[model samples]
Every structure is written in structure tokens, then in C-alpha cells.
Target chain A: MVHLSGIKAQNLTEKGVKTRMKILETAEQLIGEKGYYETSIAEITVKANIAQGTFYIYFSSKKAVFDELVYQLSSDFRYHIKIAMEKEDTFEAKQRAGFLAFFEWVTKHRNLYSIVQQAVVVDEKLYRAYYQKIAAGFITSIGKAMEAGECKSLNVETVAYCFMGVGQFIGMRWVVWRDQLVPNDVFEEAMEILFNGLTHKGGKKNWRISRTGYTNEQ
Target chain B: MVHLSGIKAQNLTEKGVKTRMKILETAEQLIGEKGYYETSIAEITVKANIAQGTFYIYFSSKKAVFDELVYQLSSDFRYHIKIAMEKEDTFEAKQRAGFLAFFEWVTKHRNLYSIVQQAVVVDEKLYRAYYQKIAAGFITSIGKAMEAGECKSLNVETVAYCFMGVGQFIGMRWVVWRDQLVPNDVFEEAMEILFNGLTHKGGKKNWRISRTGYTNEQ
Candidate 1:
């Protein structure tokens, strides 16, 4: 279900690979900024510094290029996250690392949010595929944690989607909207909610009481 | 920042209001299905069985109608959630009710996911406003819970976004994709994860072990 490589870049010369990369990058920027419907193939070709016919050599149509861009971006981020997760020993630590990797990748490709959201309108199937692939990865790692008794035995698919939602919304609020790295405090608070749940468990001090001047009765 | 009523909807006669609603409803169905750019005003009017000039009575442009549709949908769901939350006494129960209200609302307005997503491209500010309005409501409710010590004392905004993410992804996974209500077990599992955290504490039996035939050592 996952295609790890570009659409037509296989068996290409070094120059052909570069040209293909150029086209994909250009499409990413234009489509990311102007949107799919508003962006024209001519604009992509001009921005890519390639002839119109050259685009056809790499992709059959505008939608084809857009699909490849989504695929490449998904693969790139997942690879980075997988590498980051490998450096951690425990499931919680690995999950945290994976999230950090996602934020870092999104910081570099800020257009990722825009492009993926645009897919909802441009191609609904592609949009679903993008998240389904991410959820699949999460389900696998979370399933392992459950087997090890390191995590709760909730439905694997449900947990996977929940985790994806956290990563996406947190990234959207801090990185995408503010154009800044998620502050450490915000990240820790999110982790706290995910790990400890929102119910006050009595042992820990109330963090917001000191930080936000909220009075706690107990 | 929240506009409870529709744009330019004030002081209209009963017949005027009905005509206006017809335009918004038609716009929602078409935009939800074909997307914003692909769906034309002419098509909306045709489907609505109204004259082309009649659309101008309610909206100035296609974008105007789209903005109103977003506003109307946001208002509709928030109103329903507010009523649902009011019926509950505790913060946790209120939140659970809110999620239920949102899910029920989305079941009827399935195009909501697509239309709001399209706002990411059609009008970024409107898209942001949509979630921000929803977040504002969440923050107010969550803040009260934190103050009363019913919830953890983490950053209010962080908690708000996390809750929003959970609602959105869970809804998208079940209601939007599958075109069915979120199943009872799935709903209960989500509530458990939200209320109790995902770490398996010592007492409760592992639910998935029995359901999936996986043996748990502990």
C-alpha cells in the first residue's frame, strides 16, 4: 500500500533524478501556497525551469504529480520518525521521539499541512491513504507495546488514530500556525495528558496552579 | 469572535429566511461533494431551483455563501454540544456528552468534514476561525474544570487542542470514512483512554486479550 519511491524516478540517470526532484519540489511549493485548483501546470513547469513536455515525461497529469508529492512527503517523514524511534529503548520514549521527529520534519516541510489538507478537496482517496498509512505504522508499534504490557490493551486501531490526532493537532497549533517549534512546556503538557490522563491522581502537585495562578482547593 | 447568526441574515421575513436557507443548504451539499472550486453558483441555484439573481439576495458571491455555510455548521454543532454538556454535572461527563453531541451532529452532516477542509485552501482565515471558535468553547469549559480540581492542571489551551484532535480523528475514522455511527464499544474505549490514560494499571483485566485471543502474562 505504501510506495517508497517517486513515480518515475526509478532507473533514471543522475540528471533525470535531479530533474524529477526539481519538478516535485516545485509542485510542492506552488500547490502548497496557491492550492491545487488555483495552481496551473504551466506555473509549475515555469517555476521548475523545465519545458511543458518535460513534465509529461515525469508525470502524466497535474493530479499525478500531486499524488507523487504526497507519497514522497509521507515516506520522508515516516522514515525520519522510524529512525528517531530506533534511538529509544522504551515504548513511551520511542513514541515521544517519534513525535519530535514529526515536528522537526513538519518544521522543514511546513507546506505538509497545507498539501495534505488540500488533498481532502483535490483527492479524498489520497488523503485517506496518507493518514491510513501513518495509522498503520502507529498500530504496529502500539500493538507491540500492548504485548509487552507496557501500554493499555485498548483497541489498536483506535489508539493509533488517537495518537495521530494528537500529533497532528499539536503540530498544527504550534508549528503550522505559529511557525515556531512547539515549546517544551506545551509538549510536556501534551505528553502528560496522553500518559497520565486528565483526571487529577492526587500525588502530583497541580502544575497550572503555580504557572497560571489558579487556586486549588486540595 | 463567534457570530451565532448567519451573515446578513437579520430582519428577514419568513419567506426570505426560507429562500436564504435553501441557498445555504444547496451550497453545502454541492460544495461538500464536488468541492468549492468545482461547484459553481449557477449549479447551486439550479439545484436549489431558484433564479440566478436570487442567490445574490442571500450572498454576494460564491465565497460568501461558503463562509456562511461554515459559520452555520459551526454554530449548529456547538449549540447541540452546549445543550448536551449542560445535561451533565461533572466535567468528565460533560466532555463525554460533548463528544457524543458532535458525533451525532456529524452523522447527519457528513459533508462537514469536506467543506471545512476545503476552507484550508478557499479561505485560510475562515478555516482557522472555525477551529478557533470551537477551541474557545473548549477552553472555557476546561478552564473551569481545572480551577475546580476536576481535571489536571496542565495548560488549558494544550488540553483543549488535544481534546479537539481526539474528537476529529475519531469522527473521521468512523463517521466520515465508514458512513456509520461510531460503535458503542469504540465510543466506550475512547472514553476510557481519555479518562483513565492508556497505561495499564494493576487492577482491570486486559480487554483486548479476551477479545482478540491474545494471552497476557500478567
Candidate 2:
């Protein structure tokens, strides 16, 4: 396989890099509006103010541009996740905080999130790549927490998948197809239940306090 | 539009119903052995010991039978869910029971589950029909629960979508692409976390301990 990272290093100058970002950003926005199948390279070129051939020069096809857009978005998603994890104190708080940060980023990059969501169900290569790229990091974080006796000691992969299952659902429901925002606290509360359990375990621990700063009653 | 349900209503002969069931069963088995795209009307007819003309007489085209199959599957899924809910004691238990039952059925019917999952993501009209059909019932349930004050009042549409979203990712991760079976308890635990959340002062109250008698704590 021709490595894309290598191609980017060789083919792109700083100017080319800027153009590529613009193209990807534009493609992401258009895909959000028209979906993956409806959006075309011509529209992307027109929107990016570049030649159709130039679009090809940077990426092989519309799918390639899409893959790259997801690649960039996921990396950025990880960066933001890391940032939140660092800022928080405990591992549990970090997981919750990182998820909230990731959710917020997805809210901002609604377009990218929609495109990736569609890709997960639509294409085989995209589905496998998405799973490979996103799942490992998630499993590792949860695994580390389990190992350190911070989180529940369940099978890490299953728990990781459980978290992802819930996260993707939230992104689709609250971010893409909805009219209003689901409050951040609501999301945090949900995460608390997911990671912790719903009952009053006598640990006023590991959950978001409601808007009134009152923890939910048993 | 031509209606298969109408034909079923019209058929009074014992032979007619038996033949119809035979054809459907053969088609279902063949679909598992061979994929939807690869399985043809001719092959299905031959396998069922029916004539080619008879096949078309039963269903209009390839797409129609596929649609009917999925429609039936969706109906069955909803039926199982209703049964689960009706049997459960508490509201939270009802949701958990319903979800576990649904997921368990999907697990048992892996090939059928995959066929339906692919229909939603790969085919446009099929996807819409599948989504809308399932969404309608879920919307009603959420609306009822919200009105009854059984749960937190939230946007019914977004909440329904969110619920489906969780199912989608988990289905793909654990059921479709999964190399090994992720056990029922893992999914049960996930659902518990999803329904009640960890941060609530009432810790275990939101969860319905499964028939397995294990807490999803691990």
C-alpha cells in the first residue's frame, strides 16, 4: 500500500498543507450538509476555490479526502481527550472529563462527526479503520483504570465498546439530528451512571452534580 | 402499492400457508448461507422446490421480499421488546429487560441481525424505513414515560435516537464484527450504566440485576 503519511510529507509544502486543510474543512462541512454519497469532488473544489485536478493532487478521491478528514478529526479528538485527562485529578474524573471534552469537540465539529458516523455503517474499509483507530486507545485507558483498581475490573474491551456504543449514540442524537442541546450536566450524569451504577452506593462519588449543585437522590 | 399482507389474508387453503412458510424458511436459511446480494430468486426457488414464476407471483421483485423479510424481523424485534417490558416489575427494570431481550435475540439471529443492520446503513430507502419503523415505537415509549413522570423529561425524539444509537454501535462492535461472543452480562452491565448512571446517590437502584444474578459491578 502507498503510505498516505509519506505522500503528504513529499507532496505538500506549507502552502499545500494550508490548502489541504481548507479542502478537508470544506469537504467536512459539505458532507454534513449533503451526506457522503451526495457530496462530490467538484463541489469540494468549487467550495475550496481550487481546481478539480488540484483536489485529486492532494487526495486520491472523495473517499480519500473523507478518510483523511476523519484521520485528522480523530487525532484532534484524541488530543482534546488527552488535554482533559491531564487537567483532571483522578482517573475516573479524567475519563468523564475527557468524554465531555470529546463530546464538546464533536458538538463543534458536528459535520465531521456525521460523516464519520455514516462511514461506520456504510463502508467496510472505513468501518474497520474506524474501529482500529478509535477503539484501542479507549480500551487502553479503561484497561489502565481497571488495572490500577480505579474503574470496574470488567473485561476492558467489552467496557470500552460499551462506552463507545453510548458515546456514538449521544453524538448522533444530541449533536447531528437534534434541534436543541442536551445540557453538559445531563451528559455527565449519564456518564456517571454508565461508569458507576445508578444506586446510592454511599459514595457521593464519580458523578456530575445537577445544575443546582445537588447530587441526585436515591 | 401491491400488498403481500393482502395476499396472506386472501390465502385460506392449508397448502397455501404451508407453501408460503416453506418458501420463507428456505429463503431465510439460504440468506444465512449466502448473502442477500448473492442469493437470487432462481436459487431461492430451487432451494424451496418452487417454480421461478411462482416466486415472482409470491413477491414482486428481489427487493420486495428483502423488504418483507426485514419488516417481519423488525416486527418480531419489537414484539420481543414488548414482552420483556411487560414481564419486568420496575420502570428501570423494564427498559433493561427489554434491551437485554432485544440484544439477546439479535445475538441468536446473527445472520438476520447483520442483514438488517446492513439494510439500514447500505441502502437508503431500506435504512429510512428500518429507522423510522423502530423509532416510532421508541418515540411512543419515551413519550409515555415522560408523561407519566417515570423518568427525567427529555426530548423524546433525541432520546429515542440516542437509544437507537447506543444499540447500533454495540451491535457492530460485539455482534457483527466480533470474533468471540461478548457475554450477556457485559451487555447487561453496559445497559445498567446507560439507564441509571454512576453519579446518582441511589447506586444500584437503577439497575435490574439480570436473571444471571450477577451485578455488572465488574
Candidate 3:
């Protein structure tokens, strides 16, 4: 809830904003690779190819800069998801698009997982706030779906976390660990589990036979 | 797979084993509370009421003990899930039980999230191995369920991660964050989403009707 836009709002020339962003981007990459504890302002400035004094002009300190990066990461992610979801016609489509956006964004910003996870240790409040922000986005959309009879009448918040968790674990498993996009079949299977669940359709069938030649009856 | 069982395999008396376990328990507690880098062997030994020199007899160094603790946490968790799942007859029931076991276990072992997450920074291999071990367990069981026509025919590994992700996020949300058992209704809702998905019954029903007195069509 703190107003942390990652840059000073007042008295900023266009070039100053650009320099500040450069410093942040450099910090994000380094912190993601080397870790927050190991990274320093000097390193960030060096990587940004700016004077150490220039770094101070954009941020107060190393911790301050780190906080800004966290704020930006969370904001940027939600923005991407929102934009991706807007292109979809239905709620389900929107949800899928949102997930795909997350994966694609993470693929480019590879340090996201590392940096976010580190927030747990570096700043617990920031860590919780990051997920809470994302959950809020899910809650609003899921609430709408529940109202329209598209999603089950379960607790919306619980469903939000469930959806978030599934995306997170799947992303970590394939994207982060394997350094690849989630395979199409894998993504589809996960979505099926999310949309239709593991249960078979009606007593008419013993199990849902997916294209992969497996039977599922949740 | 790399045989990271944590402690050195050496000849020891019953008392030595007990002593070693005491050290591990103390270390697990401290590391979980304070983090791996912040915790030290002296603190663990002192907490365990053993001599600092006694530590080397059981483990080689601080990292060794940390690795051992990670191994134990994973093993103990699988054991709990297996035992809980055995009480259920169907795969679906087994999964619910497994998730319940996880939530219960994490509730009791509050440091679980921190400790396992810390492994990402402390030892990336150990962290990956931890999840991989859990996934392997799920894969084997889900594979069995698929063969028996009790579950859907999807990519088994993807399904395994999906299940893991759901349980983890759900647990993290309710048990870890809230410091309470997942409310029965909340748990049931999540299970419904996992087993039946967000979609409502039959093609006639476009989306599920939530008990929250709303119909969803997303």
C-alpha cells in the first residue's frame, strides 16, 4: 500500500527517469542472478555504467532500490496479465491468456522467481504484499465468473489462491527449472484440470479419455 | 537421486544416533526460524545441549547438516502423505487425504515454507531435488491411477505438478499465512476445482453455480 513507484515523482527530467530505469533494470538482473544479499549498489552502478553518485540520485540506498524493483516487478506483471486478458472474449479465455502472459513475462524476466522468493527473507511484508496484489486481481475476475455461473460457487479467494498456485508451480517446474516454455500438451492438461477438474463427465463415462490416451476420473 | 540423505553413514551406537537426531532437530528449528546463513553450528549444538565437537561426529559441516535437514523434511512429508492416503480407497480420496496431510504437517512445522525456500539460495540442487522427490511420488501414484482408469488421461507429469502446485499454494495461503487449518468449506471448494474444474455440469450448464448465491458463466 505504500506509494513505491520506484522513482522520485517530482523534479524529474526525462533523462533522469531513463537513468533511474536503467539502474533498476540492471539491479533486477544482478539481484536475480547473484541475490540481494550479495548484490551491492556499486555493482548495480557498475553494471548500469553510471557513476556511483548517479545511482544515489535515483535511489536512496541499496535496500531502497531493491524495494522499488520489487514494486515494479509486481506492477509490471499485473499489467501484462491485464493486457493479455483484455484480448480474450470469455472469462475462461481471459484466465488462460492471463496465465500465458505470466509465463511469457517470466520467460523474459527470468530472475522473477529468484527475486520474489528472496523477498521472503529480505522483506517479509514486501513478499506477502506481492502475492496479495496478484491474488486481488484473481479475486476480482473470479468473483465476476462466479456471479455469471461460469466458475463453481466455491470460496472465490480460495479459488484464486488455487489458480495462482497451479500457475506458479507449473511455471517453476517447466519454465524456471527446464528453461523452456510449458509444452502445449502440458499447458492444455493443466488447464483441463483447472477448468473441468479431474472428475469424469457424468456416470456415462468411467473416465475422461484425453487425447494423450489416459483416462481421468477425479 | 544423488543420495543426499544429510548425515554421514558411519558406525554409531544407539546413543550416537539419538544425539545426531537431536542435533538435526535443533538445526531444523533454528534454520527454519533464522535461515541457513544466519544459523551456525555452535547455536545448533548449544540448543541440542551437545558439545560443539560432537557435531562433527554426526555431520561434516554446517552445510552438511542443512542438507540433511532438507532431506529429512522431504522424506518425512512423503511418509505422512503416504500414510494418510492409504486410509482412502479411491484416487480422489487419496489425493484429498494427501493434501490434508500436507496442510496439517505444515501447520505443525511452521518453518517448512522458509526452510524449503531457503534451499533455493543455499543449495539449488537440494531445492530442486526436494520438489523432484515429491513429484516422483505423485507421478508414480497418478500413473497408477491413470492405468486403473480412475483419473484423466493427460500428461502424467504435468498433472503431478499441477496437483503439487495447487496443494502448495492452497497450503501456503491458508495454513502458512493464516496460521489455521484450511476451513472445511474452503478445502472442499479447492478440491472441487481440482477434481471437477471451474466448469459446471453438462453442456447444458455453461458454468458452475457457486454456493455464494451466484451463477458463473466464465
Candidate 4:
């Protein structure tokens, strides 16, 4: 049986499992196309070809289904990245694989961005948990790499957030917005900045204090 | 005269300007507090202490006001970053100042994240325009720095997006989420990764190909 948080899925029969998945998938499509407030439970039921009563059998309320959709999408993408990263030996390769996996997965689930973004207001805690969960995975991998001297020693949390930001914006720009795979050169350039710093070796010593009083380098 | 896009603000008297500002401010607060769909025009006018007719004098519809709020906020934050970046001499210093300015600005307008995220559903094009405008600013600054040999030469657009992602995530994590100024150590560490890159100097040569076939380094 497929496990879903906060839902009793273990006792679900094979047909019951399919019904629940249908409900979630239908929610993803309707909520993704229409803003959460604009989509009605009745609309979801109609599109899913399930009775209104059947919908209630799976989800108690619209918010409940939305929360589950966000949770499921988050888990799905993280699982993809994990599997991709597992095939790599080096930290850098692992990161690259993870990014590639993310882009590929998002391409298939284009509504992932809209559904997730709506969570900011739909349920602020759920939105935070979505990113925090992803960031936690990054923190663990980066922390291990740092301990092994495979990467620079910085605040793992900060670096994890940075990694998350890069992956998200790149995916949003190329995959979700343009409906295309991230171009090879663009992917390479992002990795270039990720694996190596942006400053040319010769320019590394040029850090300076600005008039605003913030130090540019440690 | 305070300039506003899509609104004829220059012709307004001082009172007209104030009323218009009031409407936008009220919208920001309401839309930021409650999701856009939940906030009504009547509630906005009531909170702004203006009559329903007075609200229509400034904005034609709820979406019009919401769009204007997003435009104004985007312009405001970009202006802050621009002024901050202008105070620095080196590329690194300028970037640091820009980030500091962003965090400071977000602290004041804690709703910026929610308001912008809502734009994804309220108006997709506005959402894209918001990030594109910021990226354009980064691209211009980073392009000039690259030509002057202040930073490494890479895809300027990709680097621009990277810079934006770093600033945004750092701000979202610290200023917006924590409701505290980004701690000094965290700020410095993010700047370190942004300017120098995440991999250590010694690990620069450790790039390798994984089973997934993506290159880790250029």
C-alpha cells in the first residue's frame, strides 16, 4: 500500500488506492489550472469522473486535498532527486544528477510550480515545510560533503538554501515557463557557478568593503 | 510627482495621490494577510477608509489594484537595491550591498513574498515580469563586471538568475520567515558562496562524470 501522510492508506484495497490517487491527481490538475479559491470541490469531482460522495471518501475538505497534493509533489520530486543522486559517486556529480532529475520531473508535472506557490497562502506552514524538507535533504548531503573536504566549509543551512534557490529558479525559468528542457549551455553554466565560484582565480583577491559598511569577503 | 504605471498619477492633486497610495497600501496588507481570492474590494475600501466609489476612481477592478501593488512593490525593492549597489566600488562589494539592501527592504515589507507569490495565480504574466525585471538589472551589472574582468566570464543571464536566486532565497529564509534580520554570520556565509563559489580551491580539479552522463564542471 502507498503511504500518504495524515491519511490512512495502509488498509486501502487495490481499487481504493487507485481511487485516492485519482482524487489527488484530479486535484492537482484543477487546482493547478485555476487558483485554489476559484476551484470548487464540485468541479474536481466532475473532472475526476467520481461522485461527490466518492470524493468525500478520500478527502475531507478542499484544503485537505490541497495539502496532500503539495505533500505528495514534494515527496515525489525529492524521491526522484535521491534516486538520481544515488547513481553518482562524487558530490559534484551527485548534485548535477539531482538537478537533472528535478528538471525532468518538473517537465512532466508542470503544475508543480503553481500548486506549490499557492501553498504560501493556502497553508503557510505547509509551504515552509515543502521547501524546508527539500532544504533538509540538501543540508545533509552538503554537510557530509563538507566533512569529507569535498566542498567548502560554510554554513550548511545557508548553502543548502542557496542550492535550493538555484535549482528552483533554473527549473522555473526553463522548464515551467518555457516548457523546454534547460538548455545544455545554461545547465553547464549553472553547474560552473555551483561547483566553482564565480570569480576568476586572478580576481579572487579583489573583495572590498563598500560604503554601505558590509564586508564583501570574510 | 509620484509615478505609477497604468494609472494617471501625475494629474492627481496631493489628496488624490494620497487616496491612491492608501488604496494600494490597503490592498498590500489585505492581499498579503489573506489570499487574494479571499480579500474583497469592499473590505479594501473599508480598511483604507475610502468609499466604494472612491476606490473605483483609482483602480478599475480588484485585479487592477493587485497588479498595481505588485508593480509598485517590485519597483520599490529594485530601486533600493540599485541605490545600494551604486555605493560600492568593486563588483563583490556592489553585490553584497545589493543583497543587504534587499534584506533590509524585505524586513520592512514582510508581505513582499506573499504578494509576489500570489501573482503567480492572480496574473501569471505579472509574476514573470517581476522576476524578469530584477534579472535584467542583475544582467546589466554582471555583464559590465564580466567585461571589466572583475568576475569570471560565464553565461551572463545564467549568472544573473543565480545572483537573484541567492538573494531571494536568503531573504525568504531569514527576513521573511524568521522575522529577524539575517544574522551577520549567515549573511556573510551566503556572500562567501555567491562571490567565491561553493567548492574549495583545492577541490576545483575534482570534477568528474557520473553514471548519469552530465558533466560536473566546465
Candidate 5:
């Protein structure tokens, strides 16, 4: 058994990167289905059709691949957002578009999203990496909107963090935890509540982007 | 030991519900320091200076005590909020006072808050019970406010759930995750933003009281 395992490890190393990708993809799907703690290295290797010993050659531990997966997933999310933004012109559209797209993506891939969440509680390394990737794109765009005078200029970083926190909080509350979302119109209502706020009286005499990207009061 | 445990369980049940409260209190303080997972029945017994058998008399499992502790803590939270409102007459003052008292209480004893957060990720029983306690007082207040026309006629339950999620998320992000927070003013700023929101012109808005006890918004 040991000799066969050794040969399998060498074959995996010879196969190179695809072996690693296969392991990661297998881990992602497995963790998504059975959770991180429940799924073992042996399970991942068997599912990936690699030898048990071959798993450690590509990644250090269960946690490392989880971190890499989150990083890659976040990158994909940001790429999608960038592509979506490029497809639209105005800043307002981008803001609304960003949230709508995020909500849809998260809902459609609920399993993956839950895996990221489960990773957070299971390990500390995954938690930090998770938070970093969790809302970085949304945070960056909020800063850009401030610079472009599309949104109010306050502490851009704080607003970004606040929005990310609130958005996820609402998503977790509605979709993940309770599932009482108002069908298709939830995001529209959310965006309306978020952008216009509960108090905004449409577009007149309310706060808007300035040429200087900041209000005169400051 | 089994005989002693059985006798103790019988004695505890034979007496009244007061023993349960004592066990929960010690569990709360210990679990706060040791955390939910790290905490055990032995630790609680040691802290309470009770026998290991006595610990099992009131609680079934370590998780059971943790869940019950959360329920009791939120009950105390609501009771405190009720008391704070009694001291303050204005709707604005009452709301701010309620949140202020809440922040102070939660920040002072973040261990319990951390445990509740752990429940969000770990245990299902603790999760639902935690949110239920959270929803109760918040929903009641929102319902009262709406009936009095102090705010929009929105779903109080949804708003309550959202507020609970948002408040806990920020508290976890700022207090638990960050090792340090500068200037107490940030919390005040946070509360202001939460209530009045960023859309409102900057600068602190002091909470004001209405002439009547009910409300005046629609």
C-alpha cells in the first residue's frame, strides 16, 4: 500500500498543476456538501482520484486549500463585478447593479457561499482570508464612488466596511437563515432602501455627487 | 458518582427552578472566559465550586447551558432596555438610551456576545433561540413605534431581525475582531449612522423626546 501510494504521489507531481486544481475543486465541492470538519484528506484524495499521500504534496493542510479557494472565488467575484460595471456607464447604475449582481450570485451559489461561511467558524486562518476577500471589491467601489462625487464623502473606508457588513448581515438574515425574501423584488427594495434610504425624497435637493467629489460643508 | 449525580438531579428537580439560575450564571461567567467550545461541565463545576455531578443536575449538556445562558442574557438585556426607557421619556432618548445601554452591556461582557456569535455558526438550537430573543423586544418596540406613526409602516419583524443582525455584526467586527478601538466616539458615531444613517447630513443628531409617550411618526 505504501509503495503504491508513493507511486501515486510521483504521478501526481508529474501531472503537476492539474493535480492541485483537481484536489482543490474536489475539496470545495466536498466541503460544500459535507462541511470542512466532516470531510477528510482521505476523502478529498479519493474523490480527486489521487493517492492519499498525494494530497499533502499539493497543499499543506485542509485549511490552506480552503484559503486558496476563497481567494480564487473572491477574485472571480471581483472579475464579474468589473465586467458588469464595464457593461454599464453611470455610477448610480453601478451601485445598484453591483448589489443586484452580488445578491443573485450569492443566492445561486448558496452551497459555495455556505462553505465560505462554514470555513470562517471552523478555522481562524480561513476567517481572516475570508473577511479580506469577503467584501474587498464592494469596499473599493464605494471609495471610487466617493472620488467620483457619486456618493457622500465621509470616511470612505468606514462607509465601505459598514456597507459590506450591513449587506452581508441582511443577506445572511434573509436568505441564508430565514429564507423570507420577497421573491424577485427583494434586491430592488433593498437597493431603493439603501441608495435612496428610508428618508430620501427621490432626486431633488438630496445629497448627490459634486464636481469636487465632496460636499461644501466639509 | 452516578448515584450522587442521580441524587443531585433528583434533589435539584425536587426543589425548584432557582438552582438552574445559579448554574446558568456561573456558566455564563466561565463560558465567557473559556468560550463555548473550550468550556466544559467540569470547568463550570470548578468555577461554581459544585461537584461535576451537580453541574449535570441542572443542564443536560455544555451546549444546553450555553443556549439557556443566551436566552437569559437577552431577557436581561430586554429588561435593562425597559428600565432605561422608563428613566427616559422621549422616543429619541429612549431609543438611544436603549442602544447605548445595550452597547455598554455587550461591550463590557463580550464573552457572552462572542458565544452568541458562535451559536450563529455552530449550533442550531442556540442559533434560533438567540435570534428569537433578539427579535422579541426589537419587534415589540418597532410595532409600537409604527402604530404610533413614529416611523414608516414597514414590517416590524423584518426591521427588528435586520437591526439585530446588523448590530451584532458591527459589534463582532469592531469589538471582537479588532484588538483595539480608538476613541469611544467611534461607537457614538456608529450609533448615529445606524439610526440617522449616512444620508442625513453629517454632525451628531441628539435624540429628542416627544410630548406624548406613544409616538408621532407615520
Candidate 6:
């Protein structure tokens, strides 16, 4: 519901913050690789090379770590997207940069889709909040684009989800499933669909043109 | 990956088939509600009012039932979409009907997203194949649409995934997350974006039209 208030902002000594971050990074990798149910506090400590008791100083429980990880990942995701978009000059370009940044970030994290999706079963509220937060980012940026007349007047919520869907699935298909970068042509083609749609500029009236490029009578 | 060879087609008496179906339906609900790792075979049989050993007769293990459920859900999904699309007369209409049918089906099988997504962690291969099978269906349908000039010439695979993503995130946003049907207006707006894109039809040349709707100097 709120902008992902990631883990209670813990005030800690520099060393303490580093150790906490180490624990979080280790948990992210382990949970992403092995799953939340399978990963335990003991394992996270072991993997982080810290004592089991040390984990409690940071996170209260394994579920707490998972929640914090989701929040952290969500925060990191939006931050990266915002940074990428800021470098672009146009709304369309910003979107392209955002998509590119998303693919890049997910490629590095690799466990993002798996870990975040697990929230659906692991914690329903967290699952919803995670996406709602991300969609909020989309809604704001998109609403501005519409107001600036950079886009159409279609419902912004609908547009936001559609935008999110395009990014999510394309990243899932190439970056996650295939373990490959989204090739330039593939990315461009998808952009074309987003910008111009499946209807060719010339064949605007027909939704079904023939194999030989003829618009058959409907 | 091979086509989803959904649960080995077993020859059984009519009563046996019905009992098997009952187990599957029960498993779908249980897994969707409680998640795969938490739900046990004993719990499943108990909930279904069957002997624990009887579940083994229908499925070799908990994983087997999960796999079969994924297969069954995918098969049922495609069948329904095919039927709904067939009833429509044009490619666009067929896509609209297909999306509508998909929303309706997922609404009924509310666990479809959760169960299928869990496949990522439960069985990565099954998870990938489930989506691949669905994407294959999209590719074939969208390919035909493109060939017939019903749609544009964007890369079919990219187009297929884009199509898949839109349906997925939109469904997740309204149906899965909100626990409600996708509103008619929202659905229509999404359709408009798909066919016409985020760019206004008349303002196609403007990437940054002013608040006054003027396609101003860049």
C-alpha cells in the first residue's frame, strides 16, 4: 500500500550496517537459489560466515529476513529504474531505458522473479504490496507523461499494468527463462508493438490482412 | 522443451477417472491455498475424504500430482481460449474473446497463477514448459494473425510474449491481486493500447505534445 518501507530503517554503526547488508545479500542469494521455505536462518548465517546468533541482531526471524529481502529488492528495483529513466530525455526513451534497466537488474539478481513470486504463497500482503509499490512508480511516471501529452488518454492504471506486463514477461521470457540477454531486435520489435501496435501503418483499417499482404473483406 | 505431456494419460474405469479428477481438483485448491511445500499427501487425501494410500494409485508422489495439475491447468486454459476465440469473427475480436476467456478461467481457477508460479521453485523444468506451451499457443495464433495481415509484422516470438505479458499482469493486477473481475473500461483501455498503443491516434507525430494538446517544437 505504501511506498515499500523496506525493513525498519535500522540505525547502526558502519560495521553493523555492513554486517547487516552482508546478511541480507547472503539471504537474497540463498533464498533465491533454494527458496524461502528451504533456506533457514542457520544456513543464511553459515553462508554469510557469521554466527547463527548474529542473525537475530538484524532480523527477528527467517520470515523477517524474507520480508526485508522482498522490500529491499523492490526498493533496489525502483531506484535502478528511476536512475535509468532520469538519464533519458523522452518519455518513450525513458521507458525503453527503464525496460533495459529492469532486464539488466533482473539478469544480475536472477532470483528476483522467483523470490518475489514466492511472496504470493509465503505472504500474500507482501506479494500485493510489492507489485502495488512498483505499479505506483509506473502510475506516477505514466500519469505525468499523459498530462504532458506524451501519450494517449487511456486509463493510466490500465496503461500502468500493461506497461508492467510487457516488462515482466519479456524479461521472464528471454532474461529469466532463456538465460540470455533480450536481443536488440527482439526489444525493438516489442517497442514497435507498444508504440504502433500490431496494426501496420498502411493497413490501419484491417485487423486481418492476408498472407499475401491483402486485407481480406471482413 | 517438449510439449507439456500433461499427466500420463491413464486408462481407468469411469469411477476411477472421477476419483482421480477429484484428487486433482482437491490438490489444486489445497496447493493454491496452502502452497505446495506446506501441503502433504496425507492432508490432501484427508481433505478429499480418501485413504492416504489411494492417492498413490492416482499419482506417484506429491510432485507428480503437482506436475499433472500444471499440465491440466495449461491444457484446460488453451482449450477454453481456443473455444472462445473460435466464436469471434476477426483476429482482434478473437484476441479480445481470448483475453476475456482467460480472465474468466483464471477467476474460477484462482490458484492458477500461484500454482503455476510456484513451479519456478518447485520444478523449474515444469515451470518453463508450462509457459512455453502457452507461448507456443500464442505464437501459432498470433503468427496466423500476422500472416493474414490481421496484425503487424513484429517478431512473432516477441509479439507472442508481449501478448502473454499483457494478459498476465493485467489479470494479476485486477483479478488475482484485487480479487475482482477486470473492469469493462479497464479491459477496453488495455485493448486500445494493444491495438492503438499509448500514442494518440491523431497525435502520432508528437512524442511530447503540450498540455494544450499542441505538438510543440522539440
Q: What is the TM-score of chain B alone in each candidate?
A: 0.88, 0.75, 0.85, 0.92, 0.68, 0.87
Q: Mind giving the per-residue lDDT tens digits that candidate 6 earns over A92-154?
A: 878877787788778778888999988899998999899888889988988999899988877
Candidate 1: segments with Cα more than 4 A from true spot: A1-7, A202-218, B1-7, B202-218
Residue B165: error of model 3 in Å?
A: 0.7
Model 6 regions lying over 4 Å from their true place: A1-10, A202-218, B1-10, B202-218
* Chain A TM-score values, per prediction: 0.88, 0.80, 0.87, 0.92, 0.70, 0.87
- Any idea what lDDT model 1 has? 0.82
- Estimate TM-scores for all models: 0.89, 0.66, 0.87, 0.93, 0.70, 0.88
Considering summed lDDT, which 10 consecutive residues are worst modelled in model 5 chain A? Answer: A207-216
Most accurate candidate by TM-score = 4
Residue A130 CA displacement from its true place in model 1, Å: 1.1
What tens digits encode model 5's per-residue C-alpha lDDT throughout A1-218? 00113333465555675777788778767876666666788889989899877887778888777777676666555555576566555555665455445554555444455566564455655655666655566567767877777666665545555556556655665655655432334444343344444332333221121121111111
* lDDT score at residue A127, model 4, on the 0-100 scale: 91
Give candidate 4's error at residue B127 in angstroms: 0.8
Clash pairs, model 6 backbone: A198-B152, A207-B150, A208-B149, A208-B150, A209-B148, A209-B149, A209-B150, A210-B148
Q: Give the TM-score comparing model 6 with the true structure, all chains together.
A: 0.88
The two-chain DockQ for each candidate, comma-separated, is 0.30, 0.18, 0.36, 0.62, 0.11, 0.39
- Which structure is stronger by DockQ: 4 or 6? 4
Q: What is the lDDT of residue A140 in candidate 2?
A: 81
Identify the candidate with maximal lDDT.
4
In the predicted model 1, the residue pairs found to clash are: none
lDDT of all predictions, in order shown? 0.82, 0.62, 0.78, 0.84, 0.57, 0.80
Query: Model 1 - which docking category?
Result: acceptable
Candidate 5 residue-wise lDDT, B61-161, digit = tens: 88778767776677666666687656655444455556555655565456655456556445655666676766787778768776776555556665564
Second chain TM-score for model 1: 0.88
Number of clashes in model 4?
A: 2
Ordered from best to worst DockQ, the candidate numbers read: 4, 6, 3, 1, 2, 5
